[model samples]
Structures are given as C-alpha cells and as structure tokens.
Target: MGIEWAEPGSSGHVLEASMRPVDSLQHSRATPVRARMWKFSLPLRHPETGRLFADIDHLGAGLQRRSIDRYMWLIHDRDEGSAPHVQGALRLSNSRTSTQLSSILGLPSTALRPLRDRSGQHGAFERYCRYLLHESPEAQADGKFHYPDSAVHANFRFRDMIDRYFGLADSGCVPTAESADQIRLKVYNGDMTPLEVHGRHPMIFIRNHKSIEELYYKGRHDRLIAAALAERAALKDEDARVPSTDPHAA
Candidate 1:
C-alpha cells in the first residue's frame, strides 16, 4: 500500500457553521437560534507572503520522512458546483511541522489550507512524489544516470562471470540459471542493452556488481574462483540428493 495524501470533500474555502441562542432575540419562553458561518481559507500560502509556494522535490522527500501531517496542507482548487478539488497543486515551500505551520498561520486546530493557486500543471506534484519515493535515491547517488552505458556492460560481464562460475544446467539454482540465460540471450542478440537489463533486474544487477567487485577489486580472482568451485560442488551434491521427478532432469 502507498500513502494517501489527500482527503475527499468539497473544495476551496471550507465553511464551518455553528448555532447558538441569540441574546437579543431571547424571551423567557422563546429564544432564537442564530447561525454563524466561518470561512476558513486553506493554508496553502506562505505564512509571511500569502503567496503560492512550490518546492516539489523537497516536499516529496519531507513527506516520506516526516510525520507532520498537520503541518502540510492539501492542495485544492474550488469549483463552485463541484466537490472540493484536491489533486495536483504544489505545497508550500517550507516543509515545516504541522504545529509550526499552524502556529505561523494562526490557524485553528480544525482548519486546513488548500493551495489558492495551482503551479500551472497538474500531475507534476504526483510525478515528483513517485520519483522521490522511487528513483530519487538512485538519481542522487549517480548510479544509473552517471554511467549511462557502463552499468549495462558491467551487468553483462557480471552475468557472464556467474554463468562461467556455476554452469547453468549443472547448478542447482534454477531461478538464477533462468535469469542468467535471459541475460546471455539478450546481450548476444542485441535485443536488450546492458542498461535495459539493469532496469529490468536491478537487484540482480546490483548483486552481480558487488560480487564482481569482491572478486576482482583487489586482484583475488583465484581465491574467488576456488570458492565458486566449492559452491558449485555443494550445489551438485544437493541436486543429487533430491530424487528426480523427471527422467530428463540434469
């Protein structure tokens, strides 16, 4: 499940009304109830400037790490005839705690602020939210973007190393064999590039990269090769102990 940032209801200024006895209109036996409506604007503006604010990337990251739901306002635009609109408007620049926003805006505990004006486009905030939750880390680390083609080549080499170390058909690991075969076929046929493979199988790619780094980073290939041989033998023994359900099983 994912986080739900918006709520359902009518949009724009939320009107809260209450009724109390009218003092002037009260008689001993007859009293009139006076209804009063308070229009509370959504605190979708900068507290100091009362202007629309948007710092999408920061807000996205902050939302993931922070628990200040009270501090954040739902971005909304009101249509006179429609239900309250809460969709893609950007949030305030400051990702402060709800208490802070409330204190700064002098807002009542029950009121919420929606963005008075939109930041030109809808869905941008949503996209940013997704990106922050998913791709922002890799993007920040210069993992995928920096290498461009290097990661693909690196992944290909890693797959080749694994296949060489533990022969696909001989190895007891069926899933690993299937994944390796897919990589081999794609790399050889030019149907998939290294980067594309990484995208499809990121966990495998990262694990392979780390494995390769352990093996070759300090020029310890012979030791790693010996370890792989021992692992392969162990797998072969494990495979032999299991009764073959299929006569064709390797």
Candidate 2:
C-alpha cells in the first residue's frame, strides 16, 4: 500500500509525526501531501480458507516477527525487470524456535545475571521446563507469549529498528538542499534501470534451488556490507563538517 497521509489532531494522526521523512514538512504544515512512505510486504495467502495475512507484523512495542505460518508466492521476472538483481521479491519468515529469541527479548541488557543468559538461548525446551519449575509464581502463571522475557525482547528490537531505519546522519538536523540533491543522484545511479515491458509470468519460469540458497547467503551478506559502508560514509562526512574551535584541533 502507498503512504497514508493524516491531518494533525485527526483520528489516525498519532503515527504521522514519526512517519514523516521529508524536509518540506517544516515549511508547510498545512499541506496534505505525504512526506514519506513505508513499503510493507504483501500478505501471505492461505489455500484452505483463501484468507490473506501480512507476512510481517510491526507491533509497536519493539516486537516485530514474521508470521509463524504463511504461504509465500514466488514470481519470476524473466523479462529483465529485476535486472541487476536475479530475483523479484523474497518474503522473510520467522519461527518460534529461531535462535534470535534472546536478543529479541532484551536479555543482553538486563541487570539480572542468572536470567539474562537463559532468556533467548537455544535451550528452549530446558528453559521452558525450568520456568515451569523454578521461576517465581507470578512469572510462571503468566502466558508464554506475554511473559516478561518475551515482552522485553520485543520492545528492545522495536526501538532498535526505529533508530536504524528512521535515524538521520545527524540528530536534530534537517538535510540541506545540497545533501538532498546528492542523495537524489545516488538514488538515480544506484537503482535498477526500469524495464520497457513486463517480464514472463512467474508460473512459466522454472526455479533454481541453488540460486535461491546463494542469494540468501552470499547476496544477503554483500547487501549488508554495502549498507555498512554507506552508513560509514555518512558518518565520516558528518564528522568532517564540524568546525574546529581550536587551531590545534585534531
């Protein structure tokens, strides 16, 4: 779905302030145009009941996880639409047993030494048994999904993602016209060139099992490295612009 614009003090206005991504917002507060947009993956469909469910959930309190169960549709872009990249869209799914549980639960920052190590570790079956037997009566009585560990983990990840995704190179500073122009040039240069015509229907193309695996492992790593490099460049530029107060400033 495209971005939803909300008026200040309107019924759905709560999210508008945080979702803004454009510099023009400050100059014209009364404008109705959207300053930013977020891309959300299309829903996963069920074959039995023909119901659709979102693949990703952005539950506000730092908890974001792919749906535990859903069917994903793979479409092939044989017509060169996905040129620079070999694929169209890939859906990420998360399982309850995934090893990422601990970080998600905020165990790393907890003050309790004993419980910190156990929250998100692979010894889930053991942990569950331990909680059932040794945990305080109040914690044991709470539901599994809403338990203190799970709640803390979700909030931790949510806040971290917000900072990573929405934060600018410098805090409390709007982007300058020159910097905005540079960003536009990068967008134009870095993006995949558009195709003149739509490619083959996804059903017609055959799938390569090996390519998919390579994309997940090698391609994903390469993209992450590129993102790191971009962030480093931005930080370096920001550092260079600081005015030196002392002549001997290093």
Candidate 3:
C-alpha cells in the first residue's frame, strides 16, 4: 500500500510505502548503522512576528516516530534582508535505501542530498555540527553565533540526541562566561591555542585563519599570507596605472 500527499510548489507526486512500524527497530544499544547526513532549509517560521508557521515539536516528533537516527536544528533569525527560516541536519538510520529514505522524509529524491566532506579531513556530520554550534574557526570569524538555547527550540532533545548517537560521555567542558575584552586578550596574547580558546568559548574567536591553516599543512599559512600580500600589491599597481575617473582631476 502507498500513501500520497501534495506539497505546496511541488509538481511531482510523492508516494510513501507502508512499512513496518519504526518502533520495532529500536533496541537497548543503538546498532552500528550506515548513517546518512542531510541538511534542510524549511519555510517554517514567520519573518516579522517571529512566530513559527508550523508546530516544530510536532514536526520533530513525527521525524522521531519515523525512526530518524538523530538531528540538530535551529530557527535562524532574519539577517541582512534575508527571511527567517528553519535550518537543520538529519541523520537517517537503519540502512534504508535512498529511495525509501526519500519516501520516509516526504521529500523528492533530488532534494535529498547526503552531506559529505570533500576534503576528507573530517566527517561531514562532525564538520556540520561544529559549524552549526559555532565551534569552527570560520563560523567564529563570521560572527553569526548561534546559541543552542536561544536558536534551537528543542535544545535539550538535540543535545541528548547528539550525545546518544556519538556515545559521548560529558567531559564537563562547559564554557565559562567571559567579556569581549577578556576574550580578545586571551586570543591575541598567544596565551592559548585556537582549540583551547574554542574549548573555553565556542561561540567567539578572533579571526585566526593562520592557526586553522596550520592544522592541515604546517607552514602553509605563511606561504598563503605571502601570496595574498603579493596579490594585493599587484592589484594596487594595476590600480595606479588605471586612468583617473574624475574628469576635473589632473
């Protein structure tokens, strides 16, 4: 048997096959499974009123009922003229075929892209979690910090899900509150490494691209910095040679 549902702005039909209840799949210990990670952007919030367009809890519950392995999500506030939206990552379990996964999620197969790390340095899921939690240096430099308590509606559930899925035993690495000036001092004085700074303050880090670049390739940061300086000098010389745009100027 199959069930069909229509989604707004979707032209193709969606069919979900009747499968065995997902509850039967749960066990005392979560089995090692081939997990697929996905990122989704949903129009499930109001831009102006800061209201949710749909019941987020209900949506999460539905996903849980459908046997999703784990997820972490947040409602992003409108920024720089963009509308507010819900952004999230989904980890699907049970080794279901991609087609079945698409059917379960009620999304077109084309839209269900599995996240992967192109650089092969880290797992896509881990990198994405770091990005979303503002743990990555890039995210820290971007200055768009997302606090789990304020940004995520189901923060507790998300934490529990992550801990369970990763088998993480809390190391008591809670961040201590620090003023901006204090953070700046700690980061700039070479008192601590980038990872150490991140451990203490996951949401804020002074832009230290060199430290990040050094992690992957020792001494590459200096070469890249020199190359950038050369490029800037060349651009300045090019600009100097250009004819003046002002008609009244000498």
Judging by TM-score against the true structure, name the best candidate.
3
* Per-model TM values vs. the true structure: 0.19, 0.18, 0.41
Writing each residue's lDDT as its tens digit, candidate 3 over 1-250 gives 1222223223323333333234324421344333367765444433334444444555566466446767677765533333444556667665444355554555333233466667744456655654555534455566655444356643235443333322222233443444434544544554555677556544343333344324424334555887899999999999999999998998
Q: Cα deviation in Å at residue 237, candidate 2?
A: 0.3
lDDT of 1 by residue, 60-172 (tens): 34434223221222333333232332222224444433334334334432343333223664433333332222223354354422211121211123333333333322233
Better of 2 and 3 by TM-score: 3
The model with the greatest lDDT is: 3
Model 1 vs. true fold: TM: 0.19
Candidate 3: where are CA atoms >4 Å away?
Answer: 1-35, 45-58, 96-111, 143-145, 153-250
lDDT of model 3, residue 95: 45
Superposed by TM-score, candidate 2 places the C-alpha of residue 213 at a distance from the truth, in angstroms, of: 1.4
Q: lDDT tens string, model 2, 1-250?
A: 2222222112221122236556335634543322111111221222234443222222222233343121111211121222110101111243322113223322111101111223454322222222322222344344222122222222122222222222222133332232212322332344311120002111101111222233335545677888999999999999889897897877
Global lDDT of model 1: 0.36
The better candidate by TM-score, 1 or 3, is 3
